[model samples]
Target chain A: MKTILIVIFFLYSQVQSVEPDEILADQELENVARIIGKELRCLVCQNEDIENSNADIARDLRILVRNMLSEGKTKDEIISYIHSRYGDFVLFNPPVRFDTSLLWVLPVIFLMLLCYTFFRKKH
Target chain B: MKYFFLLIIMSSFGFMFYKGLKIDPSIVPSNLIDEETPNFQLKKVENYPLFDSKDLLKKEIKIVNFFATWCGPCKIEHPQLMELSSSFRIYGIAKKDNPQNITKWLKSYGNPFDKIGLDNDGISSIEWGVYGLPETFLINKDNKILYKHIGPIMKNDLEKINAFLK
Candidate 1:
């Protein structure tokens, strides 16, 4: 009974916030929209992506993504259009730019320093 | 030498954490600053004059405000807008709100907008990059977006708004 309940809970959690009305008619386009939505951050929720967020702005963004896809816009074009308006904060995977380069560089530098210290101590 | 490397790493992380603490995560900086205002055409609310992108190009400083009848902050900021209207041309976009509620709300609180637009579908708000209600944008004479205020314009903000206008 516990295993069954766990399975049900997992199934329920998989249900996305995308409303039926927001779904695209074309299956291929809908898949593409889902992929894009998962990458775009919901500005209102901050942490949750537009695909999973229940915020009104997330819904609006999901619809906008679908509309753009149906209008023949490529994923990059759609993402960039929203990015241009909302800026780097709205992108979950932020582009490596002058301002953002530190986020990518700091982790590798920390790792190298840790390895150097570990090996130096052993030697 | 080992301690020197450790100190550098620890201080760098400490510096980043200190800088992060100073920033309020809720305040997302406006990306549209210094950029041309996005193009949009919206219907007039009630009998007010229509507003569009072209109107922003006029050689005068203006304000674009995204508001909704259902939003609490929008009500709080309404008086500031009213005070601003005496000197500035303020354009309002009613986001996802019906005309009836807007008319009634404006009547009770007073309509401060020089021209009000009905953004019933909310596309205009998206174009303007409005994530929340009561977002105000200051537009310069060159039609560039000068500054953006994310929430209700309190009395203190009036001074800042005036400074931007100047």
Candidate 2:
């Protein structure tokens, strides 16, 4: 029983493993797609807080971005397209409105509070 | 200044093209790791009379390598695989590759597999988790996979495979 518990715990920790078929995805093409996608000033990436490292999986997301671009999809449509496939994780920068308003506003409000406190004390 | 900018532009584009050529398109995704080893039962290429991949239940650590006669990496890695097979039971997946070519490859490069299976249509390779001409899978004797190498075998790979076999 203890052995089984330990084994289960070990398997649980490998959270980033890929499926065998998933290994068949190209790494180079994916990398090209990701760098272009995340850096093209998605406004969404910055708003949503996406980074620029271009990890392999992020590269996959990049390819999807290019495919959408080739399809002649607009920027807004592209943002939504990624959102639908990967959920909010697709956006490097999140938008300030709608279901994600708090993600955007809370930080701004906190900064304002900090500024107000500093200025008030100075006064 | 204009010439320097033009040089930079030309070099950048040239670098991309050179990188593309260096990058073999056969490389698939990293997603195939940690999944089940593709199931197969191909006849032996050396001794076509023999059979193999049936010991999916054993505790022996195994590596199934996909190769073709035309693939450069396959030729490069063949010698290393031959050396490793003395300690580890390596299986071969001939990716839509013919028996004559495989036999010739073995004759020149050196044969090391415990058994070679035919992935004739290139479709079986998709199941066994092959992305290119010379991908390798390190499968535990239990038929479960432990790791995968996407490109040619190198010294680092040999050490890693040895560790896994251990």
Every model's Cα RMSD, please?
A: 1.8, 19.7
Lowest lDDT 10-residue stretch of candidate 1 chain A:
A8-17
Stretches off by above 4 angstroms in model 2 are A1-123, B1-32, B41-46, B49-53
TM-score against native, each model: 0.96, 0.48
Clash counts for the predictions, in order: 0, 26
Model 2 lDDT per residue over A4-67, tens place: 9999998886332222333325576444444445533222222222224223333344444555
Candidate 1 Cα lDDT to native: 0.91
**Residue B29 of model 2, lDDT score:** 40
Candidate 1 residue runs with Cα over 4 Å from true position? A1-13
Docking class of 2: incorrect
* Residue B50 lDDT (model 1): 76
Compare the candidates by DockQ and give the number of the best one: 1
